[model samples]
Target: MTRRNRRMARLALPRLAFLVVPAFLAGCASPPVRFYTLGAPAIATGAVPTGIVTPATPVVEVARVTLPDYLDGQDIVVRAGNQIERSATGRWASRLSLGATDLITAQLARGRTDLFVTDQPQSLPATWRLAVNISRLDVTRDGTASLEADWSIIPHDANLPILHSRAAFTQAGAAATDGDTARLTQAVLEQLAERIVAGWPR
Candidate 1:
């Protein structure tokens, strides 16, 4: 209404706009992070075989599954040319080691009827222990994933020998989206599981 009041209102408008700009930029810079899990697509699922149970059947325990320190974290890792980088908007649902162990254990249990496999703490002594150490795990935005690991199956009997081996897997698919990257990873892990089962000693 008054001249002084009109000028003051115009000055206040610029100050309010400046204050709002920073908050808007912050929101745009940070998007909601999505979580993914390894071996979630169920590519290697099998119904557990049922039959007359035998006490002589062996139980294999997953002693441990470990990944490189950088790859063990929750962030989704990607290979960008020669450098490795973490995804900005995606993360692993659980630590890579735990997820990998669970995936392998579940498959091993259902894949064979003559043997049992578990990662849980067992009260009864296990006949065999399996240890896996992952040295390399990476995925590209283009949907190619690679995994390299060394593993061993050790017998509880001191006189028995251990079986040690290394495996590498490469999986390619549509990986431009985060979900696609996750599925690509699942494919890699599924292949790894199949490799492990094939190596299991009869």
Candidate 2:
């Protein structure tokens, strides 16, 4: 081999080694994934303030909720215009489909004790059934949480007519952190629950 070529090869080896070592170290030091949930804590007995009368019980079942394909995973999704990104180090405590359904049902039950909320078909006859389809539910680059859904309230019995409507809602997140993103999403869902209950027949 020529002396010049041999010298060049030796120099290239050190440069290649320098590039790979840090990448290996970085992979080892990467942070672990953090998980979050939107479910509310159990309400203690008598914790509710006075002067609020409980509404009459309404038997309601929340049918399986449908979410956009983008949010079918455990990772939290965020969007800005045409760009969308999933969290690398933060994730949902439960799958989005199940989590969203439970979150909404719980929120409704909390406000109105007379309402019985369930995710599955219950043996107890339900007077009303709620079905929700979410078109958009994501945090934006500006730290805003937005949700758009088409929801319906149908009489469990086929004889009764159906009530359907659309709701588009948004709320600013607590902060730029992942926890805040989750909190903002929960707040948006609470608003959605309110819209659904407001349509209750007199």
Return the top candidate by lDDT: 1
The C-alpha stretches of model 2 lying farther than 4 A from their native spots are: 1-27, 41-58
Q: How many residue pairs clash in each candidate?
A: 0, 1
lDDT of 1: 0.80
Predictions in order: lDDT: 0.80, 0.76
- Model 2, span 1-202: residue lDDT tens: 8999999999999999999999999989968889988765454322232234344455678887799887867888778688887778889988887777876676656665655666677776677888999998988868888899998888868988898899899998554677777788888877887787676664
Name the TM-score of candidate 1: 0.80
> Lowest-scoring 10 consecutive residues by lDDT in candidate 1?
40-49
lDDT of 1 by residue, 1-202 (tens): 9999999999999999999999899887877899988754343232235544466878788866888888887877778888877788999899878888878887777666678667876788889998988898788877789999889989989899999999899988887877887788778877887888899988
The candidate that wins on TM-score is: 1
Error (Å) of candidate 1 at residue 126 is 0.8
